[model samples]
Target chain A: MSDGVEVSVVLPAYNEADTIEETVRVTLETLDSFLPAGAYEVIVAEDGCADRTPEIAARLAREDDRVRHVHSDERLGRGGALEYAFERARGETLVYFDTDLATDMRHLEELVESIRTDGYDVATGSRWLPENRADRPAKRGIPSFGYNTLVRTVLRSDLRDHQCGFKAFDRTALESLLPAVGDEHWFWDTEVLVKAQRRGYRVKEFPVDWTPKGDSKVDIVRDVFGMGSQILRTFWELSVSPRITRRVSLGAGTALVVVALLLMTQYLDPQAVLTRMAGADPGIVLASALVYAVSWPLRGARYRDILSSMGYREHWGFLTGAVFISQTGNLVFPARAGDAVRAYVVKARRSIPYPTGFASLAVERVFDLLTITLLAGVVMVALAATGSADQLLVALTDGAVGATRPPAGGPLSPSPPASASPPSLQ
Target chain B: MTAIVASARTDRNFVRRTVGALSDDSYADYVAGVVERFVGDVQTVAADASAFGRVGGASLLIWSLDVVTAIVVFAAFGVDVTLAVVAVGFFAVSVGNLAKVLPLTPGGVGLYEGAFTLIMAALTPVGVATALSIAIVDHAVKNVVTIAGGVASMAWLNVSLTKAVEESQSAGDVEVEADD
Candidate 1:
């Protein structure tokens, strides 16, 4: 807002000696149509011009107080030159467009006002919008369509036209965006627009009347290869690399393991398993799955109790999810690597130490093993007291020596020892 | 060194043949141009003894850090950190790293753990579970450290890691083209 200037329109001029003066004059006239005198300034950002562009810009700046010449010693590329000029601009709203005046000047007020008064952080004119009337050659339109589609698909951009030269930005928004923008050339504004959207900035895109300039600036090889690579680079930064975080990797790893287990199920005849379930009393099958499902919450509650003893209290639901993820991890990984995953999850999510988590897991495993052993011992003693141990041994020996048979309950439960025993033993 | 040169020469022809089979005449010519550039680069590097020495020394140092990290992780898990144990750890790390170079999985996730566990179980008195635990912990530590460093450098430079890498690669391409 220096010198009470409300808007700064920068024309990034490289070798535009012919159009520099006229562009500045038309820009001033357009600004004057809507803005008060002394409220706007025109900057001829002369980027290392070897022609009469600098001289013309300097003379214009000298003649009119509203026009100023910001010169660079070397080529800063298109984005670089604009960024250089923008840093030195004194207004709250900054605007730029191609000096070719290809876009109609009638839309300048809307473009400026979109940011200045409409509260949009960024505003850009799109030729591809249905309302816009533009006469673009097939050569330019094809490449533009492909490039914009690539940006939208890979970078997840919402804009229809990214490389449009007519764009305006609120000074504060541009300042916040410039630091994260890596491109300093044709891709600069596109990167800014994409990043501004990501940062939740309010951007407005409106259709504008346009005409193709005399010759196109799109070099197929350079623009395609360079900008295509930039799109992938941004994709990697925004999408791929962020997923490399430990928490994300943990989730992804668990998901991959689950997918792998599902794929492994392809080895089984799913129809046969389903047929067995259908034949086996549907109520029993459903009850069995429900029984197995009930064990998970019990496990979670047990883990919560163990953690509580260790002075790390946590909710059973969260603990249940953690346990589920770790068990999923175990299905694929070897040597019970899932134990470590559980340790990591508890430590990361609940602030519990790894050693404490591992200790609790060890205690749980010991209790499980002991319970199974005690139950087996009790069964053996009961069989001996009933004088059926001899019958049981004979039945086991006969079964081992004969053809195997599926359990009576089918795949719903393990082989039924009671059914396998001799009638006397049973 | 001779083995590597022979391998590179074989790979150059292999690449040329593959591209030639897949592409037409103009693309074949482009492939030949790229192969010549590759040959020139290989010759330049092969001619520089000091460069080779520096790279080799740096690689050895990095691998040593990997082994030391494994040893620390094992010690944390209550493994006896004896001289013999350290030697076994070094062998396991080397084998694990070599196995992962095959690119069988992303970031060599499964391969590294498998090789490290196999080596540790075969050479030391550690059981399979203990060996696997040590391997998993070692790999996690190294990966976490690497990810943290990458994130820090990205923040420091105010650029994405991929963007920086792509820029450098493009710059290298430009330099090679200039030389051509």
Candidate 2:
């Protein structure tokens, strides 16, 4: 038992016979120069190595007591091997790095110093920091930038490089974070850092020189999907789980209903409304219904003309039908699901592109608003000429709907305002 | 117009930056491809300016018909419809229709009625009760006709309401796939 070791450097290796030896030798040399000989140990966690990596690592362990090799017959993946080694490490501070040593070893001193002196629980190497230098092909750089950005945005974490492969942690911090990290693969780094940040642990990032060593074993497409799913899962667990969101929604909904009911009670009188509705003239109702019927065809015609202009020629009936169905959908669904339905209907019927259909729908709405505003302008002009604008403004500001009583003897006012004689439909 | 143009430009820049940061070159290329197709459609639409003019003209006519409906309702209640009433009714109808865009209630049912009645009471010599009665009658007329016309169109187009609703709801996702 290396109970006296203050720093334990863990190198998780898999099929890395080519670079593992050099990485271990350089890491040992770096540790020897800065850390005392008996205070630190290098651990090689070789898991499911099909190459000569396990044998070479075992030989090194036999040659030097400072070097220790732990081998697993079955593949536990990089994260699993690290976890296995981490459990057995006896040092106060544990460091882990990829066998390829893609990150510069010179940053090791600062990374260790950050935890040892600066009071940070974890210190990580960041290739994305402004002072950091990363030499890699554009094909790799672009995806790396995008993936890191997605991790930062979705997890809302301050750490820039979650998968930098070079990191050091206080043993206590790792113990607290490891149990919550569910991923056993490449996402392990992200999960650990995210959980650590959420749990209020201080994380420091140091700029490092990173160079591509050899062909990467990662499947970019599969790993991107995997990492993205993990980010979403972590986000859900930390911020938007049903436990929190459902309670918030219920509270907000209850508050809104209470407010609406208060407003309704202040503004509406049920008995007055019932009496007025009972006295409504059927002849005028029929006429208004006819006018509404006329508006539908006009609306349909306008939509047909708009679609035709957009080079999506559909029959007038079809365009009208689409509008009618969408309106009905709006009546039934929330969040304007009707608009989505309308775009779908156009695509399914006319073979128009969805964006084009969406653009047309937007334009249609703009036109409708424009027309309404134009007509309102005409009314405003008339009102200004008659000097009735003040009356309207007064009513708007008064807040009391019943304060501005109509002229008692005016022909427009019903005989008994709220209890007027019922008007006959005939 | 200036405000609209500036807002659109700002929105486009925001979208571009957000997408660029969140995706690779291939995803950007995919987005650019969709934008190009949409631009082509817009250009085609712009080339035929007369069609939009015709549609605008028809919209004006439809709006005028709504004003006439309001006048008829006022006269039926023995309100002695005047020019001022006609103008106020037109303004109320326009405001009410615009308010329907807000999903305060399904089809802006309560909102439109409340807005139209309040506007009538404020602008015309009509009492609140009378204005509310007019508003209710107007909405009932329009909604009943809309439901009837929608059902008829559904039959004519061989679309079931249930199926149409479902399809419309998922249409955006389908469009996303098609865009891809």
Candidate 3:
């Protein structure tokens, strides 16, 4: 109701009929102590109250011009109610505190002045700071400590007490941050503060005297589980989503491959494989590995040619690396998932369109299949020229027991025992 | 060549219809351009007759190296280097690589080994154990080489695979927005 309200204090009320009148009176008296008449306004954000809290707020708004009553038919959550009232408030500096007024009223001036005159973007009272005078019971204190610690560690926040209700925000700063803040309920405060810091806003956290109030509506399941998921969501949005650059993708891909390799040991004994590999001629195996290594650059060259024909000329080294990453992704992921990975790499790194990337990859694959068929066809012709056609027929049909074509159900048949005699060399 | 062109046309139309159904007219048009560009690239390759010859040469050379790797693994097992066995190894390697293209498993690990072992065992006088050993060793060597090259390339390119996957996953919407 004030004409030139510089500060608006919103009290989010949900069925607080017993204390609404006294809380508003005390809030008015506190405002009168420091602010000039008509300089500040008190908004009772009555959020779908089932009791007479809305009536009391309406009466107070009517009785005093400094008090304003805003009612919501539906339960706009705590943060929602505050946001609703703040948008309607005619103030450059917006402040909000719990209806309980657990924090000493003496700190109210400091909280408002920090944003109004001190030039800070946000200011919040802390109950977790070493210098605080909060008389917290063990039941509340332990969970609060754990929650705040989690917020600090997971969200990378600097604030010690994020959920402190006694907080003030610069109107412009709050508005700039609200669009990105996804939470509507209890996680709102932590998200806002974390995002505020990330966006380079100067936030001030001051210790305040506080007393433990009566039973709060903190459900064990919702607060712990629901908010726990919210933390991960915010962490992803704040820390992971924006920075999902090519480097992070490669790192994640590598991590996935490593995890896949680790998981393979559960199904296949790695020690047995390593021992078998060791039993082989190490020199010949090294040569084989080197020969395979040489093919990678050629693979890169083929990829470059395919892309170049598409009018997207790129460095051969870069193409080779892209091929390598995609192939590696394929090695660890199923159904040629690495193909898309390669497409993604080229599109992201070279600004080539996705369609082109995919097409170039397809072109490369066509050549691969063609080359494979050509090799098999040439070898088949050679076998026929040498009077070995009968051997090919027998192999195609059934030559020996346990040596037929792989079954349709699975690729790997049971391995024969190690002591089995080596078959004829030629 | 005719099959490639026909497939290209079918793909372009499919892309256009699919995109048109999902988005607005302007966005669909932009997506159609994307498909056109893709089809154009494939057709360009198909048009250049020598491009096929050159790619064939490269692929043959690369796949020959792959066959050579298998031959070397056979040599490590002390198999005689007979022309008949080498020819059989070439066929088995080619067929094994083709089997891997099925995408049944990562890098077709089990699939490649199965096909190679089956062909080598049936064609030659090799025991199942020796054939499976050769198949496993050959596939493992190639896979190890591939993984090493991939890691080296990642470090060299200074790009993130995770980020690329994420962006590529959301590429449809992002491309439409950019074009619109």
Which one wins on TM-score?
Answer: 2
DockQ of each: 0.02, 0.26, 0.23
TM-score of chain A of each: 0.59, 0.58, 0.63
Clashes of 2: 1
Question: What C-alpha RMSD separates each model from the true structure?
Answer: 21.3, 13.9, 15.6
Model 1 chain A lDDT-worst window of ten: A417-426
Give me the runs in candidate 2 sitting further than 4 Å from their true place. A1-268, A381-386, A402-407, A410-426, B1-47, B174-180
Q: After superposition, how far is residue B100 of candidate 2 from its true place, in Å?
A: 2.5
Task: Tell me the tens digit of each residue's lDDT in model 3 across A1-426.
Answer: 546889999999998999989999999899899888899999999988889998999999999888999999977677777889999999999999999989999999999899989999999999988987787778888888899999999999999999999999999999999998887777788889999999999999999999868875455434654578689989888788898854565456456546755754664455654655556677777988988888888888877777777788888788888999998888876656677788788876788888777667767776677678888888888878876777657756764534333322222222222234341332
Please write out the lDDT profile of model 1 over residues A296-410, one tens digit for every residue: 5555666675566556789877776666655543433333444455666666556676556665665444333333333334444665675545544654465421222332331
lDDT of 1 by residue, B1-180 (tens): 233344343555655565556542232434455555545344333344544343333334434555666765554444556665665666677667666544234456766776776556544555444565567666755554434433443343343333333433443343333233
Cα miss at A234, model 3 (Å)? 2.1
- Cα-based lDDT at residue A188, candidate 3: 83
With a 3 Å backbone cut-off (N, CA, C), the pairs that clash in candidate 2 are A341-B168
Scored against the true structure, residue B20 in model 3 reaches a CA lDDT of: 56
